[model samples]
Target: MSKDRLISLDVFRGLTILFMTIVNNPGSWSTVYPPLLHSEWHGCTPTDLVFPFFIFIMGVAISFAMPTKSYDNTTFNKIVTRSLRMICLGIFFNFFGKIQLFGLEGIPLVIGRLLITAIVGYALMGNFNAKLKTYLAVSIFIIYLILAYSGIKSYEIVRLPGVLQRIGIVYFIASLLYLKTNQRTQLLVAVGILFGYWALLTLVPAPGFEITNLEKGTNLAAWVDSVLLKGHMWEVTKTWDPEGILSTIPAIAEGIIGVLIGQLLNNAKLIRSQKATQMLIAGIILIVLGQIWNIIFPINKALWTSSYVLYTTGLATLTLSVLYYCIDIADYKKGTKLFLIWGVNPMIVFFLSEIIPQAMVMISFPNPKIATGQINLLDYLYVAGVQPFFSNPMNASLVFALLYVSIWSVMLAYFYKKKMYFKV
Candidate 1:
């Protein structure tokens, strides 16, 4: 096995997470710029690529993190443990600020704060234990389930599919494929999955929906989401979710592609130049293939269409290739420090980015516009600190997002300095 430390992987993962934080935490969703927001329905946008890029990064990171030649109980336990942690975290996030009962908003906020405090206390004590972790995980799930199901009559609360949960699922599948098969077989499997998903979505007529229709809720993916997930879809659209079950088939293909690329980069026989050239060639080929397929399938992030997978994965590959050349091959390391901080504590920063905003939103302050009403701390911070300065709402929103990312970066730097890294 190659002992080469791929600094580019960390930089790339950090870059993707940084963008994800920016896109997810804009000052005001209504005022966000065009490029920062996802596309209305079809076609690709910069924002749409962030999630898939992170998943691709996970696949690449797996190649480095996991044992390649062996499959055993230890490996299986590791996979299950990491995946459950992620899924539990996802459930916590999904219910963080959303679960309120009888119009009492403070209940969920209190629960969220208590959860954060417990985790912080545990970290400070440095007494992490498997039994304690198991109990905590089970307790969190039970609490979330109660809160989620409790408000079903008056609210739309249900067991929603979360970003972390989806990542955990996809990560497990991708990791297993990497462990069980060689790179060539993985590549073939990826192509076969994409082709199969394309056929399933395009050729088969969705029950009670239009034939070959790929519209918002009319597609087969959406139908499956509705039937299987029922009230557990995205809050924005109860009928369908962007990270629904069926769409994950093609999403797994993206991870497989990442694993294949990671394996190629891991080859000790290849020189840095050869590795970079191969990735560049592969990226170009995939992009061309994606574009050609887009004509027939229509690239849609919500659907996680085969074309969308190919195009986004291609872009991720090209991006990684550039970073690999500059950072690993050329030894240009100075500029990657900020990304490195974020990369090292990606999960920690991401969880904080989400939980902080949600917590802040729960604590209300005087609304400047409405004499009788109030706004959350997050909204107040954006309006008072950033929104008032710029005439353009979009500019203000973008600046707020940048400021949010910077705040997290500062916190992450402290952790980096302390050599405190949080994984999974």
Candidate 2:
């Protein structure tokens, strides 16, 4: 490993990406295994931890990726540009295959925008003129706004923000915090956000609903989403989204925890064994505290409760500790290449994973097995090739999801061989 690069960190990130891809691309959502599916509400599950874990990992990355110089105009501009590109790319992914121009449909405008944004953001490698880079990034954001506006079907306005958009927003906030604050202040700020969010949820009644309960579409968060987002919430739940406004406050805490972990790892005074022990001890304390807190606050992923943050952050800390011990401290580097591949180009792989599935779902084909009507390509393939082998639909569904992950792993491995580490 390079002096700056941590092998364990890469492996952890890669494994997180791997599982995220699997849970997201399950063959049949309806038949998914309990562990892979998010809890209905007010509870944490394996799947519930994935999104926060990614955010936490990003936070850890900030310690490594953040500019070393004093914050200045150039640094601010770079931060804004990178954040804009991420959010714009997110908007593009959400509208992929749905863009229409001059009454023409399926233009792949989203993908095109993504490519342009990637080029401006990553391929140039900060080599281009700063003003030009800013202009290109701003222009991409404008085009995304126009396309997103055009794609909206409802006249009610207010639109659903994409998952990537939410992640970008939290990322921007967390990164700014990192740039501005010392470790002590960062920890205080993170803790404040979590508790402050909890207080607001517990004390303030939902507008018109006149209750402070955490029920779906009835809580303060959902009410905020309904009024602010209007027609823009998740399609499945038009009234509210899991990644809505209020929940993200606590999400920032996850990122802060990651930053702390990164700092811990970077502390040269501490030996490798000491670092692992410290992390493990901290994790245990947080887990216990979270469980106790859950009695009142409740560990809910959808809500992104303070208790949930504590629990997930605790788990993530422990996870990184184990990986660090095995990979970095023990010098046992066997069989980590698979994860390294995805880790090096995480967003690229994740973006493709998301968009490719949507594209597959959009292309319709005649399903001979269906007797008469047409089915989308994904369903057609599932029916003909995957669904018949097992009596349990869930098992077959899981198999299909694993296959999707395996395919991506192979593609990423090839990219790894070529050393194509696409980043922004």
Candidate 3:
């Protein structure tokens, strides 16, 4: 481990990414374990913590990244550029296979498009001339727009709000707050946002609804999404989006909480043990407060409720505190490398996790056992290769998910060995 870096943070991030990959890519979604699946309506599940954890981790990263720097045009540009790239990547993932090009729309088209975009994206991220990078960005945007509205598919209905998009926006806002405001101000803003969001949801009625409620589609957050994002909302529930506009207020608070924790962690005046102790105490307090608030607001992940933010941030803080004590403070270094590899280069691994499965599902081959006389590559691998050995469907699905994660782990290990970390 490097003297400059926190082994525990890397491990925590890697663990989150690993679990996120497994949660997202089950062999069969129908057979997933209850803990792996998100809660149906209100309440927190293990799966619900993954995203907020990542966001929290991002804030921690910002604390380490920005404190050494003097805020100037260059710093501002870097922040904006990184955030925009992440949001663009999120948009690209949402609309990956929707655009048709040269009479191609499946696996081949996806591969080609991904390759071209990767090249352009790489160039934009490279140490290229400012004018050239801007030109490349504009060119890609124009091409993407042309393809989106070319009438091949109804681009109007493509979902806009997504996980990465939310991350990007929150990161931008939180980064600015961290740069400009004092620690006291940051904490105050986080508290105000949380309480303000709670009040807005519980007190004010949505435009179309007469009552203030936390019901699925009738809630203020969902209603705001329905009006603002109309055709661009999530497909599963057109009337609402899990990553909606209003809900993001609480998400920002979540990020600010992360920033505050990061500030605590970054404080050199405090020793590792002190930091760990403080984090544990803070985590417990937040968790208790979240539960108390949940009595009225409810800890709903879909809504990104204020209570949900407090609860998950509490859990994250507790987890990190333990990791810090064991790994960083005590110097117990055994078995830390497994997660370190995945943690170091999370953005690329996550992006690959999304596109690889899509490409796999698009490629089909003959399979006599199926009604269609063919099956996609992913299903065939799961059905023929893994399912036959296990008696239980859920076990088989889980094994397949593990297998998928294991394959990526191997790839990430190689990347780690080569020191080839790709940042967004």
RMSD of each: 3.1, 2.9, 2.1
**Model 2: ten consecutive residues of lowest lDDT:** 151-160
Candidate 2 structure quality by residue, lDDT tens digits, 155-219: 22434476667677777887888888888999999889988998998999998866688888888
- Which stretches of candidate 2 lie above 4 Å from their native place? 1-3, 67-69, 101-130, 147-159
Give every collision pair in model 1. Answer: none
Q: Could you tell me every candidate's TM-score relative to the true structure?
A: 0.91, 0.91, 0.95
lDDT of 1 by residue, 1-424 (tens): 1245588998898888998899999889998878888999998889999989988888887888874558887786667656666777776666555544445456455665657645643432233565555455556556656655665653355656877878988888998899889888998999899999999999987898557788998889998998988887787988888889999889899989988888888788999899999999989988999999999999999999999999998999999999999999899998899997888777776666777777777788679899999888889988889988999999999999899888888888899888887765
Error in Å for residue 208 of model 3? 1.9
Error of 1 at 334 (Å): 2.6
Candidate 3: list runs displaced more than 4 Å: 1-3, 105-107, 120-154
Ten consecutive residues with minimal summed lDDT in candidate 1?
Answer: 120-129
lDDT of each: 0.81, 0.79, 0.85
- Name the runs in model 1 displaced over 4 angstroms: 1-4, 98-156
2 or 3, greater by TM-score: 3
| CA error at residue 145 for candidate 3, angstroms | 5.8
Error of 2 at 212 (Å): 1.2
